[model samples]
Target: MRFRPLRSTPTSSPTLAMVAEPPADMRAVVIDRTGPPEVLHEASSPVPRPVMTELLVRVVAAGINPIDAKTRSGKGLSQAIAGYPAVLGFDFSGVVVQSPYESHPFPAGTEVFGMLPFPRTGGSYAEYAVVPTLSVARKPTSLSHVEAAGVPLAALTAWGLVVETAHAHEGQRMLIHAGSGGVGHFAVQLANYFGAHVTATGSARNASWLRELGATTVIDYTSTRFEDVVADVDVVIDLVGNVHSDTGTRSLGVIRPGGLYIVVPTHSFPGYAEAAAEAGVRTTGYRVVPDGSALATVGRLLDSGAIQVFVDRVFDLAEAADAHALLEEGHTRGKIVLRVSDD
Candidate 1:
């Protein structure tokens, strides 16, 4: 509910002269109260300005994730931290229009993509987003805005679990749930790239696609119980938390002694640790944070085709409610993105 001026005093960048003044008000998908996807509606709000160490970006595309919907429904982290009349989006790819601090690495007009601060106000579901400089990295040239928008949050979750937290390496057996979903697709690819033998769970229809994303084995969760067939796994990345089934607790049985069960859900049921202890395995809940350096590494990998981003569908910004509805169906093959503006 605070507003800052869109245009600050000109910085040293020569491109500043070419940067146009932002509009007084811009279209944003805002949630005034918690409910279903219909609660998210397009509204007009003041164009947010960059403050110290922040970059004001003109968003070209934004990525939709389950958290956005959970937040809108007042069921997740957003319910605790988000103020009413808040914009609900985290991942974005855009061009920087203004940088307010001298130490900011990106100049005016830099094409950048990254996740905003999680469990906080990102306001990325808008025409313009003001983000901290350290949270963004240069966009990958090989990807379009929509493709780049899909990478940050999902890729970061995968990277944080496999590379940073679990330290999965060659010859390790890693199991990823929801392998065809946004984060799962990225986790499968990144784990394989890091030399781990990856197993992923999804429907039979997604088996070949999951394999192409580096899933060595794709378990059809609809027909098979993962714990029954999969055992002695070094790491289990549980994106499908303990919501419908005992996924978190059952995953403990598959992990080998001293192996890790990284829960990726924002919230979990009680006694996960006790179950892990009973199985002589370790358990930790993982949350992705904003890291420009890590995102830069991801960008390099994306540009080199070492990792690929899969976009299942693209919706216009006005259709943001529809996007959330589709994501809630919980069976998207990859990521769904909202095209905010043209490049």
Candidate 2:
């Protein structure tokens, strides 16, 4: 993981010139060996210098996602990691402290938020992070750093599933599983905002809340089997796969013939394609990619209050293990975020 040095700093910002540079090394929660949550411990890591079109961001907060827990347990993207002492985080909200070049659109001191393609590169579980210029957008003026941190990866995933893949539109009927979860909550809102009729599955406790997010029908998974009640839907966004129950396979039976069944987690099921084929429905797997342009559009929607991001809890950087523990319990209403540095 060698990086080229930034020969030219963003000197155009007078404030940037006056401020001292970031520390050479920073405090980060890291794991030398993948294991349980307790494996995450504090360590001093070199503050990465941005190269090429990258920018150095002083991370104010980082969002916790299910993938973080999976990777920590030697699953998910853990195989993609090149070495030990890996820092795992995907979504971040922070200030740009170093730009690829002077006079860049997002210069030093500019507030931004985005997701990192972790393992392929370093991640956000640190005080400072290396961010691609095109992977970030100006943070929404309406959200604080903690709130903003919760948006990127989850929102992008939902946007990709609902709008980009399903083409959510008027009269389109969509079923969203785990509707109160980090990505599920966003899926419900984006589908409704795009004029789709939403039916969501969640606990009875979350039923009213999911309705508030625009789900016309909220199925309590504890009380009712979703496949029995939901049928002939235009799209089914399955956040929970057959790993928990027969969710992925059962979801196929609900979608109308030719309807799309989008599976979010590949690790959750083994043979979804064969299941969807037998059920006579079209299917696809989805993975969220960082997109500043789409994120910028999402920022606009956020600022306008057309959609909302719910932060279920906030933990300090050192409490990353606790955050991961909560995530594994699978009951979080929205997103859980780690406060890395003060905004």
Candidate 3:
């Protein structure tokens, strides 16, 4: 599906209208009960209003992260969304329809994209959303709405781990597992940008692509063990979670003493942290929180050609079920986005 790009120049803005109020109900992807993808229902919900520190945005597109589907399957949802009827999505791009204050960075009609507050609302899979002002930023001018929609969650997760948490600096060596996955791909580029020598692990077919994305070394995890290939690494960013605990444990062996190993998946293994400690390395388990400032930082990088956005696939909003199915296969190259109509 094709999308109309948001005009990013000062004189060029999106041609969206401003009305006194929106309709009482709007279309949304609602999970009435947590089960499978088939249980997801499309229904009408109230058009959310902008409260203090919030902006009401008309969603042009929403990005699908693997965790969104995971949480929907009764795996990640907590008491925050324990009720049956729930909205599921975190990353989105759209026009700011209204804001609580006039001094808002995103005034009415500003084009923006970022990760919304998760668990508490998870309402980005809708025609409109009420998001905190600090949780969003001006959308990148170089990308279309659908492409920009793909940036928030996965990209930020990669950035926060490589740049913020691990502080992977120049002349350092790092290894990233699952180099072709959403977060893995970004982690590769970001690490390289920080002047680090990056080694990444993926299938044989993805090795060339990973190199093009700035991976100094690419390992086909299918044929060889990455730990056996890389040694004395400064950092290891593991995105495969507990499902690959052994790989995470082995990652510590590659990092030198006092280096860092950061885990990006849900649960942290008891032995993984202990092994890192035993090896005289630091270990951290992270969960991403919404950060608009980071989005602005990323937007500037994108605008200056410092970073690139990787979109593995685009699905229409109605084909959300198919998108989730593809992501569940565990081999998506980059990010998957759901394109919504301007009407």
Candidate 4:
């Protein structure tokens, strides 16, 4: 099946006076009951139409994140906002199919990629998605649909912490945990790009690769305790959370006084702030927001090769359960994406 674009000519008068009938149904991954990866299965649903300031997107590829798996298992933020039989996914690259407004920045057939509003039903794991114009941006011309799809959510999260929250700058010391994972890798690069001295923690095997991504110091978490070897750091971006023995709390021991520790966890872990308070440091839990403008700036970085997206694997849409299983393992080197269609 192929999705064709809709085109419109400029006119002073409104072209679409009434809502158009969307497709009867479209293929997607739907969860009837939250449980395990088995709960995520391929199904069909009515295609969503562009309403008000929205645009209907023909999704070419969808990116997989740890949150997708958590939500599938009834443990993530989406549990509260998503109804049963919900389509689970957030990041996607696709073409604009129907535009409801003339003032929409992208016209019909414009290729775009973005992370949909998180903790909500994005329905990106489908052939079609309805997204607000403010949440979409033109895909980076230099990246394939698969690559662009791998970016949005993870990249934006990294950008939010490093640039927006931390305000990391030249000569500042920044430490990032799980430096080889999706968001960690990007945070390392972005912090480095902003001229901070970068330190990262990962397996010994990924030490060289993390260094290549701009980490001046790569600590093998298995062989050395990062808190023991690294100190007086300005920022600590903790992606590991409390998974491996109170990583969030232990990270507080490494930051200098007045430094910031940003926690990127789907669920809140206790004692993060208390530990930081004792250490005379700041702590914050960050959730990524949909920002088309910030994503566009990231697209420019991708186009210029200042930053690179590492797609660890790509799964077919039919194998979304398998993708979820892999992501749940929690050791992917980079992003895992689902190829929805050929661009």
Candidate 5:
């Protein structure tokens, strides 16, 4: 799908009259109960109102993440679901239709993208979403809403892992597993951008692409064990926990003594901390929280072409189930996004 580019970031939009108020109801992808991807269905729901520094947005697209699928399948944030027929989404990109106030910087029609407060309010799956102001930022002008939609949660997580957690910098050596995934891909780029020598593990097909994204070494996990070829890294960002292939445990062997091991999927291996301690490595689990400031900074990097977000596929909103299904296949190079509406 083609998209109309946003004019610029932090602009005083003149199109405020076009979006004075939202409609009474809106289309949404809701799950009657947590089960599987097939449970996601289209339904009409009331338009949520923006209260207390919130913005009502006309959703142009929504990004599908691993957590969305997990929560849909009765894991991840599923335990926190308040009620049935629940909307499930976190990342979104669109235009503001209702501002916090008349003088708010983000007047109606200003383009933006960010994450929703899932569990608290997993409402980004709808046509219009009420988002807290601090949880969103202006959409990168260089990207379409679909691309912008794929950013927020995944990129923020990567930023936190590579920049905040690992403190990636020159003279550092980092190993990232599942290097082609939504967060892993960004982690690879950010680690490299910060001058870390990055070694990544992905499939053979993604090896060259991962290299192009700044992976100094791309280990094809299919043929060889990453622990065999890589060792003594300053940090190990394991997106693939032991759930699939004992990846988290195997990663402990590759990190240098006292180096950090960051587990993105915390529950994938609950005993990981104990294992890492035995291996003489520091370990911690990381979870992403909404941060508009961090997202805005990522936007600048994207606009400057310092980094890029890969959208592996796009599905219409009604095909949300199909999107989630594809996401679970675990081979997606980057992100899968739902085309919720036009820009």
Candidate 6:
């Protein structure tokens, strides 16, 4: 993968210097094997110490991603698990408990929210999560812990696709499939923020909500064929997999040549890569990285009400199994979160 030239050099703030460390033996949700969410079990595990550029956070909540359950259910992510007794979770909101680098901006009490790359020991579904300082962002003051927890994976995924992958610009025409799903809603708002002329595909029930998020047009995926009504797009963020393979594959029809089609779950989709090539379109899948700086920016945006977080459900850590079941249903709007500790 190519790296973008650094837009700005990293800056240090007082918030970066104040994070604290956790004591050993904290309560955390863990999995011994991959199968069902039932595989995730509560365990008293050693609280990890942050290394250079890492911060230990006292987790208040963890965001649930569809991929999280996919990994649990032995799908695309099963091999990503190294062994049993694995901790599973990525997005988290918490207070900074410790930092190895004194130049840190998040002081011991500073509340922060962000995503961790998967397969790490510092799982977010615990009393504490260890995050690379780069991936951690200060939580937006206007949002509650549960709300902040929901932002990282889905929101960042949207940001990565709309802003980074597709390079969506103001007045550009864009289409977001599954506009009511966790990542789709954020794509609508973020793309709109960039001045894109946005169209979103979702159920008729979410049309008004999509409009509120800045979708200029909303297609009821159930009642209308998107290809039949949509055309001439600069970008398409495909969130649905084979379930809408025809729509996803034919999405190329809408893109102007030199346009982009980004599929979140197409890694396992049959002929996805080949289809993109045949259509003369550029397409790629992505895995989210820890970007503390981006999170901080998102926090500021949240505080200003430029973006809104949608929570479909919140479950206690003990109910993580139930949470995964809900996610597996595949129709949830916005995000599902788990309350770990407290605010």
What are the per-residue Cα lDDT tens digits for candidate 4 across 78-178?
54754667888899999887787545678777899997764454569999898888888899999999999999999999999999999989998999989
Candidate 6 residue-wise lDDT, 1-343, digit = tens: 9998878768665544554334768888888878876888888988877677777888999999888888888875668777767778889998888766555576677788988766855578789777877888878889999999999888888887888888778789999999999889998999999899999999988999999999999999888989889887888888875664577777877887878887777354577778888888887877665677777777887899998999999999989999999998878888999999868
Model 5, residue 212: C-alpha shift (Å) = 0.5
Model 1, stretches more than 4 Å misplaced? 1-18, 101-104
Compose the digit string of candidate 3's lDDT tens values, residues 57-106: 88999999988888878787544685657788999999888876656667
Candidate 6: TM-score?
Answer: 0.90
In model 2, state the lDDT of residue 19. 29
Any idea what lDDT model 5 has?
A: 0.91
TM-score of each: 0.93, 0.94, 0.91, 0.92, 0.94, 0.90
What is the clash count for each candidate, in the order shown? 0, 0, 0, 0, 0, 18
Which pairs of residues have clashing backbones in candidate 5?
none
lDDT of 5 at 235: 98
* Candidate 6 ranges beyond 4 A from true positions: 1-21, 101-103
**lDDT-superior candidate, 5 or 6:** 5
Which runs of model 5 end up more than 4 angstroms from their true locations? 1-18
* Model 2 misplacement above 4 A: 1-19
**RMSD vs true structure, all candidates:** 6.6, 6.0, 8.6, 6.8, 8.1, 8.1
Which ten-residue region of model 3 has the weakest summed lDDT? Answer: 11-20
Off by over 4 Å in 4: 1-22
Error of model 5, residue 208, in angstroms: 0.7
Model 6 — which ten-residue stretch has the worst lDDT? 13-22
Output candidate 2 Cα RMSD. Answer: 6.0
lDDT of 2 by residue, 167-278 (tens): 9999999999999999999999999999999999999999999999999999999989987787899999999888878888888888888999998886687888888888
Report every candidate's CA lDDT: 0.88, 0.91, 0.83, 0.87, 0.91, 0.83
Clashing pairs in 3: none
Q: How many backbone clashes does candidate 4 have?
A: 0
